[model samples]
Target chain A: MGKIFQKPEALADVDTHYCPGCTHGIIHRLVAEVIDELDVRGRTVGIAPVGCAVLAYNYFTFDFQEAAHGRAPAMATGIKRVRPDLMVFTYQGDGDLASIGMSEIVHAANRGEKFTTIFVNNAVYGMTGGQMAPTTMPDQITTTSPAGRDTDEVGMPIKVSELLAALQTPAYIARQTVIRAKYIRKAKQAIKKAFTYQLEGKCFSLVEIVSTCPTNWGMTPIDSIKWAEDTLLPYYQLGEYKTPNGAG
Target chain B: MTHEHLVNRDKCKGCGVCVEACPKNVLALSEDVNAKGYFPAKQARPDDCVFCAICATMCPDVAITIREIADQAPTENKGGK
Candidate 1:
């Protein structure tokens, strides 16, 4: 009999430290599956961020470098420049990527780095006890914003994918979600495409995954998914924001 | 042909994400809890399983793995010839 539906080879054997309802585990599995299918685990180097996924290196069975707060893109840039043969990718959260590391990501993309990034935008700052991140939706209630996010006072939330897509440099920027089976499949496809483009030395590729933070959002796992579908999806607008060929 | 869904009880966190994603309604939170004091998901209706593996896909912890067993074929009577 043929084997079907098992753990991906690129993923570590030990259990994850993610929360029960956190989508980080699903995202990690998707990335691992992509790495396994691409056969780039040996040549891949992941940059772990300072956010909730700071320990992402522990989950993946490959060489990983820990970067400072919002500095993954810079670290990845240096690594990829020095060793062009290796596949470098950064696993970052909304707080790390969209906030403090904004300049690094922008400069990296503008320079047209040949690396991929898995941007997990859970809206709130998960590791920092649910603070208001740069990607936090309008009127969203976070620990820092007890009275809900005041867009007028704090300005609008940064749409990282769209922001990056506006640059003149060639890139493959997409926004995807993994709340359900259908979306998970698409997210995996997008992730694989990003890595494939990087392998071909096309351009900078980033897949912004609109994920859910049930614990931080103050909702149950199932309800948090529903919330994300109702609120986050409409705001984030999931799709291929930019491509090298300029085909949506 | 038969298909079996194995749940690694120790790794399960009993989040119920798999239970809700299972189209066949084959999984449910078992009465017994795991080492983490959480009710791990169990196959409540094994007969209705089609081995679609939706539960495994939605599983966050990679605690579930689906396997299939093919039936044996009949042997030909070569002695008579």
Candidate 2:
């Protein structure tokens, strides 16, 4: 065995500020690994959202831009159009994408922007405490929904991937989870494919990764994973929702 | 002295995700805390290690790294040179 596994070079070699067991670190590492694998680190630009991953720029070694809350997709679209040669992506959370930035992402995806998006759906507003989000699971307890989310009043949780897939645009869309080691590999595969689609200028791509927020969920990291597997996974439903090749 | 495994102590938040995923029961959280005040995972029964690499995959902090150094150059050739 010679170097079975090691940290990707695109990632900065330092301790991050993420809470222990937070899957944002895992997703960040996966993106860095994909960037390294594709040899695009030199020309890659990342747009960090305004949520918990706002410090995403600090973790990645490549050039990064901070976007206004819910506006990462719009920023990414502009960057991709201006510098078509560079690889651009946005990292966003549920609240940033499905709520405040819903129109930005929707129109960007509909316009078939060449940039890719990595949407991290932890089901709540993690950065600003456990506030209810558009993707918050029904009957889930959140700071804003202390009595548990009532689907009747707020409507059911928004299925971002499915909603995006319903669009007629030929793009790459996939939903994957990182709640366990087994799922991490699959999630990386989906992420890599999203970037690969962008590399070929196929179309707009969004990889919705169902993640866990241990701090906001008020559970141990392990318990959070179990809770997500039991509660969140059932609703999000992981799979490729769209592809340029017309294969699901 | 060969490094069968290496862990960056500072990088490890000691969430025990790797420990729970290790099928061989090769790792355990140490009693002593690191500089960050978190107890990191250590090899408790290294001989049982199969080097599955799942620990590295599960470690969100990128703390766990697995290395394997063959004793010698690979003897078998599967492709024609």
Model 2 residue A163 CA deviation in Å: 0.2
- Candidate 1 chain B has its poorest 10 consecutive residues by lDDT at B72-81
DockQ of 2: 0.46
Every candidate's DockQ is 0.47, 0.46
Q: Residue-wise lDDT of candidate 2 within B1-81, one digit each (tens)?
A: 133566677778889888888899888888888899998887777767777788888899998776665455423321101
- Stretches off by above 4 angstroms in model 1 are A1-3, B70-81
- Compose the digit string of candidate 1's lDDT tens values, residues A167-202: 877479999999988899999999999999999999
Best by DockQ: 1
Candidate 2, A154: how far from true, in Å? 0.6
Task: State the lDDT of candidate 1 residue by residue for B1-81, as single tens digits.
Answer: 555568888888888898889898878888988888878888787667677888888888888887664655422321011
Specify the CAPRI tier of model 2.
Answer: acceptable
